[model samples]
Target: MKTKKPTQSAKQAAVRYLSRRDHAEQELQQKLLARGFEQEEVDEAVALCQDYNWLDDARFAERLLNNGIAKGWGLLRIRQEMAHKGIHEEVVSHLFEDDEFDWFEHAREIAQRKYGDSPMDTDKEKARRLRFMQSKGFDFEQVKYALDVDDDEY
Candidate 1:
């Protein structure tokens, strides 16, 4: 009878975790380690996954960017989230550089949906709107355009 190999167990555990969603290499390693796997076993599993093209940080970043956009998240928030997942800044910058979506337009739409079509009439209201957009991760320019621009200005 053959004993269960540690590397095989590690690989199986990694695959199971990956089945639910894509994970960055560091993220996967940490998860496996947290699950009580030895560092050597986790390393072997990660290497095998990478060899099979099953673990790719670039692919994970791309998917994350797309998903964040679909969920109405701004670039700042998306980048921060990706960083938390162990994605490199180079990958995040590269992906964002190629994206042509009008962030201002998206911010405007989100603000309009949350507040209304009417322009902010008071300093207090404007401040409140600005805070809301900022909380949603929009930069100052995007938030200003969203809060200050009239529908006809577009």
Candidate 2:
């Protein structure tokens, strides 16, 4: 049995990696390394894909943000996720600048969907829901407006 050549192995690995889903260069490199590919081979594979426009950090960030937005995630959560995925601060900042990334509206919609028309009668449940909203990455103002609880309720 003959061993596969390094270049052929890298190309095969890259193709297998890309077959699963779209990946940024960094992500692809990490996957290749984890799969036991040598550094030089991984680098070559990443470079080749980049040359062909198959891997792009900016495009990856944009697609991730779009998918997150479609799933109703707030700006804060999305930003955290982007950072975790190795997306640069500048790209994340630009996405946050768009008004369509409003967390307040998302919070309102979420609150309404979970607990419609102020069904909670006691302070404990309100507090629980408030905590839930905060945990969901909503600010106090947004949660208050979303829950529609009067000041006296607190």
Candidate 3:
């Protein structure tokens, strides 16, 4: 009996990748490379996914942004995460455009729930909260607004 070699076409690999999870084209290409596929093979696989509209950067960015925002992340954090996920700059820009107010409201609500109606009076405590906000991906302005503290004060 003769054993048949795996017909490892790019489309087949792309289908496998999509079956596992949604992926940006660049991300899928990187994964394919890491899995021992050659550059040409990875490129072809990415093209296949794109042709099928199964791996779109814009769609990935939208989904990623929605998921992160729903989890209470600020714009800065969401942008960074989307960049890390290999989304193009244009896509990131589109997602964040005209979203400042929405993101601010989200940050404010998160801060209010986490802290309280009253602002922290102590400098050290306020500083700590500011740092925490930064770590959570908020810009200084958003953090100040959310915490209801002045820039000079916080």
Candidate 4:
């Protein structure tokens, strides 16, 4: 007689992955599939997770948004990241629709911390600062506001 090995079920794999952190439905689904689980099994596992409220895109989006804000990320960057993670557009938009957080103010604070209170003197210096802000996922308007805000305002 040959000894048989017990294989891990889709639910088992999914639960293990979820233990580490929250994951978007699509992200979890992809991860489960990549691990060599059958497509139907992966789908059933994902559906079960969703039914049990173990997988919530809204919750994931909220956590991601809050984390990005804490990290001083601009709205554009945060939005892009959430989208890439497969968060629903409605969830992303709803989180950003609140008027409590001021993106412009956030941009100014980030700029002050990065480049200090001193104004850029040369075009080259200004360009460099602009590039930095752009790389941070701020739009041109926010970047301009950040670069031009008076030091006395701080």
Q: Highest TM-score, which number?
A: 4
What TM-score number comes out for model 2? 0.78
Q: Which residue runs does candidate 1 get wrong by more than 4 Å?
A: 1-8, 149-154
**What lDDT does the true structure give each of the candidates?**
0.84, 0.77, 0.79, 0.84
lDDT of 3 by residue, 23-108 (tens): 88778887776666678877877877788898889888888888887777887888888889888898888866766456677878
Clashing pairs for predicted structure model 3, backbone only: none
lDDT by residue (tens digit), candidate 1, 8-28: 488899998898989999999
Model 4 per-residue lDDT at 56: 91
Model 4 residue runs over 4 Å out of place are: 1-6, 149-154
TM-score of 1: 0.85
| Candidate 4: clashing pairs of residues | none
Alpha-carbon runs more than 4 Å astray in model 2: 1-8, 150-154
In candidate 2, what are the lDDT values of residues 1-154, reduced to their tens digit? Answer: 4433445487678977777777877778877777677889899988888788777777888888788767656566767778877777887677566646566777899888788886787889989999988776677888888888777777
Which candidate model has the greater TM-score, 1 or 3? 3
Provide the RMSD of all predictions against the true structure, rounded to 1 decimal: 5.4, 3.9, 4.3, 5.3
Candidate 3 Cα outliers beyond 4 Å, as residue runs: 1-9, 98-101
Any idea what lDDT model 4 has? 0.84
